[model samples]
Target chain A: MKTICIMCPVGCSLNVYEKNGEVIVEGNSCPRGEAYGKTEFVNPSRVVTTTKRSGAFSYSLKTDKPVPKTMIFKVMEKIKKTPLKELDVGDVFIKNILKTGANIIVTGKLTI
Target chain B: MSSFYDVIVIGGGPSGMQAAIEAKKEGAKVLILECNDSLGGILNQCIHNGFGLRQFKEELTGPEFAYKQYSEVKKLKIPSVFGAYVTKIEGEKITALVRGKEKEYFSKAIVLATGARERTAGEIKLAGDRGAGIYTAGTAQKMINYYGKLSGKRVVILGSGDIGLIMARRMTLEGAKVLKILEIMPSSSGLRRNIRQCVEDFEIPLEFSHTVTRVVGRERVKGVYYAEVDENLKPKLETEKFLECDCLLLSVGLIPENTLLSEVEKNIKKQIIVNEFRQTSIKNLFISGNSLHIHDLADNASEEGAIAGRSAALFARGALEELGEEYEISFSSAISYTVPQRVSGCGSFKIFFRAKQNFLRKKIVVRCEGEEIASKFCVGITSGEMQEIEVESGKVKGPLTVSIE
Candidate 1:
């Protein structure tokens, strides 16, 4: 498996291959790169950031943590289609969004 | 009521926030005057990752990066006023319209962190009818990434700048189809990683040496007509082709919003002229962030803000030690322009610059009085991104010049 780690500006190219039943990673600068490669090759997840319409304006949101890559669209649809009220900054508006156990919280204020 | 402070920072974005933090750290009464409802500036709408790498060494979103500085301002208990419209600068005093009332502010020193704005459709001079569905790249990003609304289904983006590329990906992620991105220059003005992830990964076509010469549509955009350009980037009318796109996103460029400092706004290649300490021609008045020069990363802007803040604080307290013998910094033919065109003979400071064209594996050298003060080997040097050089304290004297060989 080959992928680019979008973790930081370094953008290290990772080549993950299984050898002798053990997954080996190369071209990583730090430990985070190794962890990123292994997790990405196995169960990939990402912290999604998007906007939600509320009244006349919109509020920016992010998943509390990384969610399954396969469930990203579902999470985005659930967030976009849902009706939102005025939110304070850091408000956890949606609980268990996408049933992925990740909550959607307001990273930007709508009430301001 | 009119209030007084030791330092007044205009435009409460990342630069203003960081400036306030540094000034407050110097034990001076500071006040931040922001025109927007919030203090983060454009960072609020930039929700994507890849910020704060140079500062925190952590990948944080735009809002998160702004929050880091905002939290510091809160902890310092600095006074700030949002929705304050700055009128103009009168000598050392500042005046603004705050809370629907005109208020005057007195400050010993002022820091102008008033960021930049996007160049619109008119600025680019597209020969076409004025119609709807025309948006600046930043405006569209704010609409989709911040407002949660996709303006159009099929889009043709002009300019392959960072914002344009970012929106190409954002619009695609939100289900809006981005037809293609057009650029007048043969190369992109954005980071290489952005080109790889935002455009290449998504399979979005970025056509170089091409530009939209005209736009079609009246009430709303129906399509855009673009053409291949010559070496001067002038469109060749014979090679024009029309592509049907519902929306036209202009990712052309950004210009500094230095309205209050218009009196002394002597720009060096479209950027404010400043000294080593981020001080402009007026000693007490310092400039930082995008207002000084268009920085590729926000962390650089924050760092400039801190320098301006500290310098302003020192100037205000009359404790600023003079670094005698100021020398003008010059650049070679390969360099576009250098920031802080003036430098002090003593103390260490960083100077930022851009290349005139693209080069691979080039040697960047900085010389002071014919002595090589600093040199570095760079890979993939492009005109779009900024290059920096750090001047070591007391390394050399007199006029400084930087060149790429």
Candidate 2:
């Protein structure tokens, strides 16, 4: 399978395939790209970034770590239903959300 | 408050904050004036990760990168006034309205870090009635990421810029059905990583060589008439089709906001022309960041701001010296405009530009006086991303021309 590495803006085109009981990855400029190719070929995950509303203010939040790609909408559904209170930037809104081992933390400031 | 300073930086975005930090490091009294109440500017609403890679050597989200810089400015004790709308810039004097009252400030040197604005629907001359559901990509981003409000239930994005692609995913994640992304060009103009992670990840349809010929709605967008275009970018009447979309988002392009410098200088591209030091034609007036030229990354803007800040401080201290004769940096037709339109006395300086088209394993060569000064082989260079090349300055006798082969 051919895919583009999203590790950075470089976006190295990577070729990931299984051959003879071994997985092979090629066309990466860096080791991170190679890792991304391998992981993506196996089980894909992504760090989701979005906003959560509390009162009249909205604060940008993101998963503290990458979660399984298949469970993205489920995580988003949890984020939408989760009620947020007065919080500052860097504050955690949800802990280990959906057993994904990723906490939802605020990335934006709360402006009234 | 003292009405005078050694240096005054306008716009407290990433570039403005970096400029203020660098100026303060030079032991110059610097003040930052921001129109918004916060310092982050657009980075506040950009919740995505991928920033701070070049600057901090770590992948950080926009807000994370912004807060890091803002903390530095705070640590330096650089005084900044938010909600200060600058009205005029006459020489080294700046007039702004702070809390509805006009205030004047004087400085020996000034750095204009005012950023860029998005191209609107009217700017692109979209055939549409005055609608309520149309928004620029940045505006939609601000609404979704800042206000946590979805713009529409069904979205149709025009132009394949990075913002449009990011919004496509954001809207989808928010439960909005992004019908499709239409690009007038034959290929996507956004970064390949964005195309992979944002659009392709969600299985969103991206149609190239297609564009909305007319907007079909009143009061609020209900749908749009789109068609495939030929090589000349002319829409084929026979290929016209309609798509049901409640909202249309445009991610066309950005124009540098240099309205304050209208009396000082003018460029058809709306970008401020500056030298290697980021100094404009007017002495002691420096410009950086998007006001000078659109930068693909915030890290480059901060780097440019640092140069401009240092130069502004030196100019304020009356220690800046002339750097010999200036030579225009020319480029071939295959290349787009080069920043620092002119170069003056440099040991080794970087020139940033964009290619007109995609090229793989091409050589970017810089020549001065018919002598090849520098050349580097680039891999998979695309017009979507900006490219920078370093040139070792010699006693330049003629125009420096940069070409790709």
Candidate 3:
């Protein structure tokens, strides 16, 4: 498994190899890199955004923070229930929606 | 006649001072031409904390941060002429024309660090009269913090940028009543922490998606008409409303000072374009700081100044190669723009970019010819705070594309 650690400006190339149900990683200089690799490889999570049926049009809603590396697909299911109002870019959906108490923020502008 | 040095730096602001210091460290004699009587640029007027957090690891006010750099210049003993306005720079030798009360000087390698100017109310074409109460946020800050004069008793800030927000808090602390902060965009353009501290903590009402449509007053500002924007950012008719305020502060934006560049007039579109090395089209000329482009923070400007300074020194030593034509820089994905459009492919390079908007745990993948070369993720990136990615030599081979995802 391999991933890029988006911790800061020093984007180190990260490579993760697994053996005997265990993972070993190399090439990252930061502790965040190691944590990202292990979490991403084991349960891959991401912040997700989707549109919900609103009164006039679609309302784009998203989790305020990153979720379990594996729950990205399931969270999208939950987000489909909330209709996104005509929100501008960078609007917060929730302070902490991950349930784990981590904050996920919006990444793009709402075109509609 | 004007005298010449190896490098001539314009503007004695932090960027200009730092550039001169860096050039001196590289064994190059440098001259800094400052237009003001003092060396500190905007920092002299900005007396707030939240500076020197990244650079010094300790928080300091703007003036204190500037004094540290000023002391470094003194230690290095870099030569500079204060109260000197650089009128122009010309030719292969990079002769610069500057005027002072008594004398003028010319130099070899010219560096434009003229900094930037605040965008006035007239430029934005806001429907209003030339009232006495309207002022740019920076001007208001200078008046209050530098001259100890209050422009108005009550204020309605028209922009939510760092300066405006800080002014809001400053005014609140000074016993002035803040009517509201009208921001056109939905999100504050200032740092997140600033929004928390200045607006949220101070109990200032920050109205997003709102803009001032017209100003109402003849002799002085009596009120301002504002409204919320629709999905297309058109002011919603139903949302129109008027608020009473004596002062209107425009924190809209800042424009780079490029009048001197036009005197010598080189190939440029919006601003004087430079390559990754911070070198301009002319061989012996360089530009950095606000003169090159607007940066969010002062520390970033200092870093750019260092790069331009060091590169100018290399050019003076005659060890620098002609910046190659093969490697060009392009911005895509989530980047607003990248400085130094081309890297000479000769040395380690630093690339600076501003995100189009905020990001959440996204990776910035640097690609060459559609192949991934380097990628890094940021916990979050914003348009206000620039993100700098340094690429060592050999990692980049061809043209580069940065995508944030």
Candidate 4:
């Protein structure tokens, strides 16, 4: 299978295949790209970044770790349903959200 | 309050904050004038990851990247005034409207990091009624990410800029149906990673060499008439087709916000001409970041801000020397434009530029008086991303020309 590595802005085209139950990735310029290709080909995941609103204000939030790609929309639904109050930057809004082992932390500062 | 300082940095965004931090480190009394009530500028609304890859050596969301810079500004004790809208700049003096009262500030040197503004729907001459659903990609990103308000239920995005591509995925994740993305150019202007992760991952339909010919709604955006374009970018009337969409987001180009210096200095491609030190033609004045030119990455802007900040501090301290001779930097038609339109007393300086089109396995050569001073081999280059090369300035006696072969 041919895929583009989304590890960074320097997108590298990768050729991934499994041989003898071991995954092999080619055409990657870096090790991170190889890992990304393997993981993407096996079970894709991504860090979900969005906003959570409190009263009259919104705070940017992101998953502390990458979640399964198939579960991204599910995470968004969970975030939308959860009502959040005033939170400081770096505060975790939800821990182990949906058993994904990723905590939703606030990234935007409320006040300077 | 009216006061005099050694350096005054405008904007207080990613670039502005870095400039102020560097200026303060140089032992100069610096003040930052920000129009927004808070710091971080546009980065606050950009909640996506992929930022800080070069600066912090780690992938972080836009807000997280901004928070790190804001934390540095706080640690440096850089004094900044929010809600200060600078109205005019005359020589070393600046007049701003602060809390509805006129305020004045005088500085020995100034750094202009006002950044860039999105090209609007009117600039593109879109034949449409003045409707409510039409919005620039940045505005829509702000509304949805910062205000938590969905822009529309169905959308048709025009232009494949990175912001537009990102928004397509954002709106889709928020449960809005992104109908399609239309691009006038033959290829997308956004990054390859974005095209892969944002559009292709979500299976969004992206059509190149296509554009919206006319808008089809009066009150709100009901749909749009689109068609394919030829080599000359002319839409074919016969090929026009309508797509039903409640919202139309435009991801067009950006223009530098250089209104204050519009009359003072001549501009090329709507960008203030600066030297290697990020100094403008006017002495004691430095420009950096997007206001100098649209940068693809915030990391590059922060690097330019550091140079401008250090230069402004040196000028304020009366340590900067006068230029003896300067050489003009020119580029071939195959290339777009080069930053630092001119250079003086160069000793291995980097020149950033973009290609006019895509090329594979090409050589970028910089020549001075027919002598090759620098060259680099690129595996693949595109007009969407900026490229840079280093040139040694020991024997440069005439104009330097950059070309791709």
Report lDDT (Cα) of residue B51, candidate 4. Answer: 92
On the 0 to 100 scale, the lDDT of residue B209 in model 1 is 98
Docking class of 4: medium
Candidates ranked by DockQ: 2, 4, 1, 3
For all predictions, the C-alpha RMSD in Å is 2.7, 1.5, 15.5, 1.6
lDDT of 4 by residue, B29-137 (tens): 9999999888888888889999999899999888888889999999988888989999988889999999999999999999999999999989999997766799999
lDDT of 1 by residue, A30-89 (tens): 898898788787887777778776776667788887788778778888887888887777
Superior candidate under DockQ, 3 versus 4: 4
How well does candidate 1 score on lDDT at residue B290?
90
Which scores higher on TM-score, 1 or 3?
Answer: 1
DockQ of each: 0.42, 0.79, 0.02, 0.69
For model 3 chain B, the run of ten residues with the poorest summed lDDT: B92-101
Model 3 regions lying over 4 Å from their true place: A1-112, B92-104, B263-269
User: What is the TM-score of model 2 when looking only at chain B?
Assistant: 0.97
lDDT of 1 by residue, B57-97 (tens): 87777888888899999999997898999998887778788
The per-model lDDT (C-alpha) reads 0.85, 0.89, 0.72, 0.89
Q: Give the Å shift of residue A60 in candidate 1.
A: 1.2
Model 2: CAPRI class? medium
Say which candidate scores most in DockQ: 2
